[model samples]
Target: MTDTITEFDSILEALHQAIEKSDSAAAIRTLQQADHDQTAKLIDRLSVEDRQALFGLLTPEQGAEVLERVYYFQGADIIEELSAQVAAPFVAELDSDDRADLMNELDQADSEAILEELDEDLAHETRRFMAYPDGTAGAIMYSEFVSFQADMTVEEILNDIQTNRKKYIEFGVQYAYVLGREHQLLGVLPVRNLLFASRSQQASEIMIPKPTTVHADDTIEQLEDIFEEHNYLGLPVINKDGCLIGIIDRESTTEALQEAATEDLLKFQGLMGKEELRSMPLKVRSGRRLSWLSINVVLNLISASVIAMHQDTLEAVIALAVFLPIISDMSGCSGNQAVAVSMRELSLELISPKEFRRVFFKESSVGLINGACLGLLIGSLAWLWKGNAMLGLVVGTALALNTTVAVCVGGLVPLALKACRQDPALASGPILTTVTDMCGFMLILGLASLCLPYLV
Candidate 1:
C-alpha cells in the first residue's frame, strides 16, 4: 500500500507538470508508462480541458482501457465531455457489465444517444444487462460465461474451449456451466475437473449436479452470503424460469463487496455522494458536503440545548463544564466501537435486523463492565483534583450512566436503520454523537444541580 501510494504520487506530479506545460506528447508518454489504475487516478486530477487533451493523445482503445479502470461515475463524467462519435466507440469496447454501469450513471437521453452509436448487437446486449435493477446479482454479473451441453464429450468441450481460447480468456472463465434442454442449468464443471476427465466422458457424468445457484434478482448481500459459504470461482446466475442467464465471478463479487464497504465507511463519516473527481467544481463539492453538514448542525443543536438547560449548574461548578467535553467525547468513542461491530455484523449477515434485542443486551453488558472500570478511575482523579467527594461522585456516576446509554444507542441505531431499509452507516457518526452528548450532559448536569449545595 505504501509503495502504491508513492508511485501514484510520483505519477500525479509528473502528469501535473506535463499538463501545466501544455505538453500533450509528454503527458501521453507519462501515461503510457502507467497502468490503467494509475492513469485513472491521474485523469481525475486533470482539468477538464487537460483531460480532453490527454484523451485526444490516445487511440480509442487506450482511452477505453483507462476509462475501464475509472469508477463508474468518474467514467461517466469523462465520457460526457467527449463528442458522441468519439465516445460511442469507446463505450462499445467496454465490457458488457462495465458498459451497463457507465450508461446507468448517465442521463437517459445521453445513454440513448450513445447506445444508438454502438453496433446493433452490442447495443442490444448492453441494454439487456442494464435491464436488471441496480444492486442485484444480475446487474453485476458478466454475460460472457462459457457453457456446454450435458451430453457433450470431454473432448468436444476441450476442442471448443481451445477454439475460443481468446474469448474464454477475456471472460476470465473459471468454470463451465453444464446446460440441459432449453439451456436450463444442470450442473457446473470446474475447468480443473475437466483436465482430469477422460476424453470419452460426457459432461453430465463429471459435472457437479445441483450446484449452489443464485437468482438474477437476488440482492448483493445474498450473493455475499453465498460467496462466503462456498469457495467457487464463479456462480451461475439463473432467471425465474431456471435457465442460466449469466455468471457472477468471484472477482466481481469481491469488488462489489469492497465497494459497498467503502461506501458504508464514507456514509459513516458523513461524506455521502462526494465520490467525484477532485477536479469537480468547488460549488458542486461544497453542495454535496453541505447537505450532510447542514443536517448535522440541527442534530448537534439538540445536544447544545441540553447544556443550555443546565446553564445554572454549569456556572456554579465550572469544573463540571471542563469535564463536559471529556465525558461526552470519551463515551462517543466507546459508542463508535460498538457501532463498528454492529455494522460489521449486519453487513456479514452474522445478525439480522430482528436480532437487535440480542445485540442490545450483549453490547449493554460490555458497556456496564467498561463503564464501571472507567468511572472508578475518573472518579478517583476528580476527588484528588478538586478535593470534593460529591463532585467526584457526580462526574463518575454521570460517566458510567452515559457510557451505558452510548453503547446501547450505538448498537441499536444501525440495526434500527437496517430494519427501516436504510443504510446502516448513514449519518451514524452524527446521530450517535448527538445522542451520547445529550445523555452525557443531562446526566452530569442534572446530578450537579441536585448536589449544588455540596459542590459549592
Candidate 2:
C-alpha cells in the first residue's frame, strides 16, 4: 500500500508541474492515464489551487468519471469549491447513484442548485435515491440496471446488447434482469448463459426464476449476508410492491461492508461518527472526542470508589495493593477475548440476541476451565513468594471468581445491547473495564479482610 501510494504521489507531482508550466495537453494526458482510485487520492493530496486547476483542465465528462470514483467526502469537498454552474455539468454526467450520494453530502442550497441544472430524468432518478434511508440496500444500489421482457428471444437480447454496447457497459451490466409487466422482476439471465442459449429460445425459458432478492429497506448487514451466501455479480433490489428498483453489485456491497467495519472499529476506540481529517479546525477535532472522554472519566470513577472502600485493607497489607492492578489487568484481558468472540458471532449472524442464555453457558464453561488452571498456577507462585498459604488462596480464589465473572459480563453485554437495539461496541471498553476492576478489587480485598488475622 505504501509503495502504491508513493508511486501515485510521483505521478501527481509530474501532473502538477505540467499544470504549472501551462502545458494543458500534458496535464490532461497525465490525468487521463491515471487509475481511478489513484487519481482520487492524488487529487486529495494536491493544494487547493492546484486541485481546482486540475479539475478545470478535464472535460466535464472526464471530471464526472473521476468524481464518481473518488471518496464521497473528497468529491463533496471538490464540488463545494466549484461554482454551481461549473459543478453542475460534472454532476449531471455522473451515474445516478453517485450523483445522488454526492448531492446528499452537499449543502441543501448547493444540491438544489445542481438539481435545477440537471435534465429532468436524471434529476428525478437522483431524488429517488436520495429518498432512501442511509445504510439500506436502496441507498447504495445503482439505478442503471439492464432489464428485459420475459418474452424476448436470445437473438433479440443479443442484438439489443450489441446496439447499445456502450450504454450496457456503462451500467456494469452482468446479469440481465427479466421483468414482467409493471417492471416486476421475474428472473435473471447471466450474460454467459445468454451467449450459449439457443438463439430462438425465449428469455423466460432460459432465466433462473425466483432469484434471491433483497428489499430496499433491508439494512447493509442483511445485504452482506446475501452477498456472502450467494456468489453472484449483483443482486436485484425490489420494492415492497415487488417491483425492481435497482441493482447492488458485489463490488458496491463489498465496499459498504468494508466501510462499516472501519466505522465500527473507530467507534470501538471511542471515536464517534466519521473520521475527521487532520486539517479540520482544532475545535472540531477536540469536540468530537471530548464527550466520549468525559463519559469514560465518570465510568472510571466507579472503579475508583471500589478501591476507596478497601483503603483500610490496602493499608494493612501494602502487598495487596501491589496485586490489585495485576488481578484487574489479567481478568480484563480474559473479558476482552470473550467480547471479541461475541461481537464476531453477532456480526456474522451466527447467534441471535435472544440466544444469550446459550452463549452465556458455553462461554462460562470455557471460562471456568481456563480460570481454574490460571488460578492454580498463579496461586502456587504467590504461596512460594509470600510463604503464606492463606494469602495465596485469597489471591487465587479472587482471580478465579473474577475471571469467570469477567467472561460472563463480556459475552452477555454485547448481546444485551443488541437486544436493546444499541450498538454493542459503544463504550464497551469502559463498561467491561469497570465491571472487571470492581469485581477483582472487591474479591481480593473482601477476602483479605476476612483472612487478616491468619495473614499477620
Q: Against the true structure, whose lDDT is highest?
A: 1
TM value for model 1: 0.86
Candidate 1 on 272-349: residue-level lDDT in tens?
A: 673745678888788888888999889888999999999988988999988899889989989999999988888667
* Candidate 1 segments exceeding 4 Å error: 1-30, 83-85, 107-109, 119-124, 131-136, 153-159, 192-202, 219-230, 274-277
lDDT string, candidate 2, 263-365, tens digits: 7788888886556666445786798899789998888899889889989888888778777887899889999899889988888678998988898899899
Candidate 2: residue 132 lDDT (0-100): 89
Candidates' RMSD to native: 3.6, 3.6
- What TM-score fits each model? 0.86, 0.84
Relative to the unseen true structure, what is the Cα RMSD of model 2? 3.6
For each candidate, the alpha-carbon lDDT, in order, equals 0.85, 0.85
Identify the runs in model 2 with alpha carbons over 4 angstroms from their true place: 1-9, 18-27, 32-37, 47-53, 76-89, 99-124, 130-136, 153-156, 196-202, 219-230, 279-281, 348-356, 454-456
**Which ten-residue region of model 2 has the weakest summed lDDT?**
272-281
